[model samples]
Target: MTTTATPLALADVALRLRPGDHVAVATRELRRGTQVALPAADGGLVVTLPLTVPRGHKLAVRAAGAGEPVLKYGQSIGRATRDIAPGDHVHSHNLGMDDADRAYEFGTARVALPPAAVERTFRGYRRADGRWGTRNYIGIVTSVNCSASTARLIADQFRGRVLDAYPHVDGVVALTHDTGCGLVPTSDGAQVTRRTLRGYASHPNMAGLLVVGLGCEMLPVDGLLDGLALAPGTPVRRLVIQETGGIRATVRAGVAAIEEMLPAIDALRREEAPASALVLGLNCGGSDGYSGITANPALGRASDLLVAQGGTSVLAETPEVFGAEHLLLRRAVSREVGQRLLDRLDWWKGYTAAGGGTMDNNPSPGNKAGGLTTILEKSLGAVAKAGTAELVAVKEYAEPVTERGLVFMDTPGYDPVSVTGIVAGGATVVVFTTGRGSVLGCKPSPSIKVATNTETYERMREDMDLDAGRIVTGTATVEEIGEELFERVLAVASGEQTVSEELDLGSDEFVPWQLGAVT
Candidate 1:
């Protein structure tokens, strides 16, 4: 919008919007006294109304008209739901897009990707069964809270010994959580527990795994095995802290077991494999106005390329995609996938409402500070992280994504919880986009951080790996960045260290979603 202020007005010059946008996310901090230009009839429709909006507050998107609702993201982020005047700030009080069991226009928005995938390859650790890995580590997974420390001690034994011995074996990691005990064996918690435990034990990235548990826990080690379809005790090793005599005895025996397993684990080597075997996880956090315009679309391009190569990718953060669900439904491969996605969304609405949270609670304070004002706006930008691939399947949270194409997994918008579900669902690599800077990682599966802008990347050089912000800076196009992201994924999958790995991140981020009543 054109400004009327004198020749040299330069106060917190934030995003100056044009007529097409509905909301403006704060790229820079805004103070109460900040003066901005408003839409004037004489200046024509190109002028966007401006107000002195605080960092996370919404301002009137020009006085609303009787039939005119404030638009966000160049689309109907929501509606006025009531007559509004121009220059009146818009927010939850005035606008509402309470979508309930809404049907979407599908097959109308399918983006035809460029003919085929670019020829790209990476040095990946090819498994005996031909699966590829970003890192080869021995997982010491705890099935009960009692064995948590024991698992840590077992993993710690190989931390920093003068080791030319197990160079190929990445550091052993203990995957533990606070649950897995104190629950009914037939309950959902038990089922969730079993799924998570088995997902790790048989995860493609783990070269070998040692299942640890306290024999007396309700969700005992043997019960967990019954739920999984593994060949036998041959592929994995197990230890019960109690049966091994004591902590000291268990640690000693665990070390011996790992010593025996290391040589065999090290025997696996990297080789050529089809990119289709790759299952990419689409994630976004610390977003900004530039996220959708830059990194997200770029990620979409990369996703489509992967799908074309016969690979699979998953788009998660279900609540984050609330407003943009229609966009995806339009691209659903079948009506069933679309309906299943809608069913999950319906469940979330009821669940959130019963919990006293409105959909408006979706856009985090950080998201609002970044220019997203409503769930609709935030969702639109968030889905961009998936890139434009066909909507093949939509699974419940943490459900393994076996379909070899682009799919969506239902998850809460929280970064760690969402990524954990994706990882647990069998994604070996994650490509996360950030504009405000999210320092995150998911191990066993390596994450590649792509910065949406040069500024954030420069500010946190040590944390971000690729500068997807280059797209906004004009250093590269989304296609180029997408290609770069694809290459980086393969590199990380093949064992190249992501920035998070190099900095020893991802260790504390192994949080599995605990889905049970807090009783």
Candidate 2:
């Protein structure tokens, strides 16, 4: 079962992510009885498949008794529910979730990264509040769903030619969500809504902002301002439809306010800034088996590079990182940081249970169809986006990320919601990894989409910003691709438009994490 040969070629069409992994991923559909060549330390070994193995699916590389641990990435992804022979398809049918004991030692593997060779800088807007922004846009924020349409109409007026004179200001964007009404103002949901709105209203990327409201909703413009503590003299305007006489009147008023502020917003200019000013949001969605093997790890390397440069990277999606939290705990800067992460996990366990769901109830239908068997397998891959940096701090959802290195924010696994929290936390740039081809974008912060495999990258080239699939195809190494991504991040931060931004994809993706009953 072992050999001393060099690792198999990337062209072999199959891969074992780690030396101790008992299962290997199929790069392409494997037919029954087909001999698959597996690289071993001593020499090459061949296994004949007993069943068809679809692309991205796993094949058992060694025999496992019923209830035995199934190993991948050199870690136990799950346990076998039935005896599995070598070459058998390993999936949900024969695999089941199990809670295994993990050794949680804080700061055991913490290492200070060496500074990068090149001192990189990007052109960014330096705000008076001492925050750097990649984009200078006028944000029109709605306090309640009742004013969502009015906000859109106001922004629509400036959509194309209206903002032609304001060359320094990015297009006006209306950030509207479905909540903000139909819930008690004192409830958790209301607090979350208000906090999220406040974050956007005072975001660094917004040179100026206009708050729109229907006047009587539980979440009001004035209430949001009261909680936000916005600095005096900051450029902000407010309008309420109920107070402005009606919808048309409010739209006109909102447009007038933005017009009055345009000259000042357009006065802001981009200046050269160090990479330390960059706060990158690490995200992944529509993931598949190739995720861990390719894009996620490559993104992790890029994150490590960012940390080396004194920049901050934020890894989110709390439930998505459930089973893999132990790996992060070991990198925690202190016991307190590790405990904070564990606290969030404990909260999620109760949150999901109370909803009659389990943490393993993930790997959405799309994930399963893409060959992900369980949340454990997905989580191990998802955390790769964090790289190996020490976890400096863990913050609650929508909280600003103050630490300079890698940090984690507690957020739901949903792409839109998770990214929204990240952007609200002051991320000026985002690198999103995806295997199933997600066309997502976020305003204020531009999003860079990386595809995990060549097929998806080619199919979605119009939307994907980079191709990490080259790592899997042997065209490039992880470090090389990571360096390439790092360069791209700087370019995007320096006023280059991303594919998503060019396509105007961020308008509908603004969703805040709602935590209480909707009623």
Candidate 3:
């Protein structure tokens, strides 16, 4: 990446991330003929806007010929679609990408982070399996869509003040999905669903678990629990809607079963544990131009801090990291880990091709509205959440995350499904970054949302937990915001409720990655 020496100031009209970046992002709207002083790092050039550029949009700082590469973050974002003048706006209208092959050089840039100067600790629940939990949630997991309503009804009984006596217990959550019956038992979809369900049933954060199922489904209740071993002394129960005299009877039985288990579940108390016990999940959504410049990089710095303390941080949304995969490859700890990431990318290539789509078909409408132009541009920004830690491992969707430091889990870019796979993989807490805005939460794990820009943060103050926009506005450095975020992570892990938690928003987002036909 290109290095820059200039520090941004409040009066700056635009911000240039690197020395040789082809475009600089507008700090605020600039009408035609407005003059901007490019940062000294960007060669101290003065340019006039040929057309109006919206806040958070990019403006060309240097001329480019048609099909020439447009550089940002000191790397190629995409090739120009037509001749682009030095003062013109740079966006989808004149920028696009191609499927150019990237050469892999594993372990070439790997650098081990120095150990933390002082050991950090958080108050967490220690489980019998030698894992730590940030929350004490009782989960109602359903085996099929058919039993979803019954599970929800059962969970609803404990809402409001019913759990007031159980101060330690985070609410009872019903994690339901839209699959289970029509899928072939031996199909890939069935395996993924079964794996995800089993992961949740045995999650360290779950103080108690209840599995609900319809009597006749491809994924049987007995088979689902065949090899599952939850923490020792953890309460568990099972109910079948069909065999329990339909939905009403099952709901009654389910609620009663949980009531009986509450004492034991609530008895668990938080104990101080080393920071290594924390597994932080990293993800982003509703990205705008400032996402890469602010929140994403700030989250990355926080991820690096956790990793330096010997903790694990997981970066997901494989498709979101498409064009920027090369960056991670260079930092892989081994060729095996790098190759595993490649294998998953290869699978995605075929998967998208089979569905008549391309890997570049990302940057959703919200992303574009926020000034992101292409998947390449979005991927580069998205990968910043991983920080500069050495890539320790690559895992399949919903696979258990056993490695420490920075790990990669293959998942689609959809926020809910991506976070579900991460939580299933053992992330005790999540740090989600957003530019436009997102109200996402994960059950059994607390999610901390950080906004990329101050405008969005102030506009949706109730939804965002932190504002990384301070980085671009010269009020704070990236390291300062990052340190603040790390502190927030520790605070939330120690039984503090996040905005999403206060609003009770996680139960409706348990979407497992369905991989095959319903049949």
Candidate 4:
């Protein structure tokens, strides 16, 4: 039989996994006693072993029956459908998953990672609000249904001209959305929508902002600033289309406002900083087999480094983590944090069921073709993107991240909506992993794509930035590649454009998750 070979030491792998973890990634095909390398550091003789079982399945220490829990990572992966032997490999052979049957031992093993005593830093824009920004941007925020065109015209006008003067600032982007009008007045949805918009309008990343509105809409332009505590200034002129006399007049006013903001925005300069200032948005799409084995795990390691350095790293995509919620709960910093995540899980269950869908309705045709079979399988793999950091907090979509460590944001699995919420929450940079190669991106906050395997990296060489394939191909361990990924984050934060962002793939991709019935 053949084996993957890595020249580096994976001796630290056990640090991230439990000793009783049933699976040992095979070092060489053996009838038995393969002497697989374990760390002599865990106070044990370093040795590896071969499985008497078939490939792709891991042995279980305890027996589990139908609808019973199968434990891996010392947590429930899913429920078993048939009786499993003590040493039987835990997989689809005897397991089935149902949301109703899923249970958790909340607060049982929640670990609070003591804040890494060392202060951290990163290359970023120091916003006036004391929040460090990963990218400097000129924001064009539309206030009413009337000023959408004016905002677009203004953004387009500054595109090339502004970039030339302020090479440090990302050029004007008109954050145009279709829902500025026709919503229930003073309703919860309207409030949340307005608050989210204001958050973006006054986001730290924006060097300057221009708010433009039409004469009227259900969401009034004049009232938009009433409750917002955010500070946005110079070049942040608000103009009403009705007062301006029409689209042509409004465009002129908008252009003048943006032009006024340009000189000041151009004067902002970048300064040396620590990596801790970086807030990383973790995402994955178009997954394949290597996603779990390589890129995602590597991305997770990078997350660990960020957290260790006092930076924030966020994990999103609620549907993708459907079956794997318990793993996160176990690592949560406290019962309250774990419970908040559980609440989101419960809401999603009811929400999807109301729409006549089940959580197991996952692992798309593409995912299955790439070797994933069920939602549980996909989630177990997807959780790797969070690394092994303790869950510090669970946040609402678009809410500011308060924790200085690993955090989770509840969001739909849809990529655009998820990324939109992420950017709205103030992530300065994003790291996306894909096995089948997703050429997706979010502007203002640039994204770096990591390929899960060598073949995908080769095929999409121009699209992917780093390859975590080295893990599976044995050229590197997840830890080594993780550090590599961490360094890449710094490079990108310092203004490197990811392949997808360079190709301008972020337009037509702004979807805010619609969470309610239209009634």
Tell me, by lDDT, which candidate is best: 3
Candidate order by lDDT, highest to lowest? Answer: 3, 2, 1, 4
Q: Tens digit of lDDT per residue, candidate 1, span 96-155?
A: 664444458766777755546365566676765556676777888888878988988887
Tens digits of per-residue lDDT, candidate 3, 1-519, equal 222244233137677777678888888887776666655554566666677888898888877899888988988888999998766899889999856776779989998999999999999999998999999999999999999999999999999999999988898999999998899999888999998999888888999989999999999888788879788888889999889999989989998999998998888899999999899999999999999999999899999999999999999998889988999999999999999999999999999999999998988999988889989899999999998999999999989998999999999999999999999999999999999899999998899999999999999999999999998889998889999999999989888889999899888888999999878
lDDT of 4 by residue, 96-195 (tens): 6645555676656655555667665556777655677766777777765457667778778765554686676577778777676777766756765676
Q: Could you tell me every candidate's TM-score relative to the true structure?
A: 0.87, 0.96, 0.96, 0.81
**Candidate with the larger TM-score of 2 and 3:** 3
Candidate closest to the true structure, highest TM-score: 3
Question: lDDT for every model?
Answer: 0.74, 0.88, 0.90, 0.71
Displacement of residue 79 (Cα, Å) in model 3 is 0.6
What's the true lDDT of residue 76 in model 2?
88
lDDT of 3 at 477: 86
What lDDT score is found at residue 8 in candidate 1? 18
Model 1 clashing-pair count: 24
Ranking by TM-score: 3, 2, 1, 4
Model 2 lDDT tens row, 209-285: 89999998888889887756554446888898999999999998999998898998788789999998999999999
Candidate 4 ranges beyond 4 A from true positions: 1-100, 112-120, 144-147, 231-234, 517-519
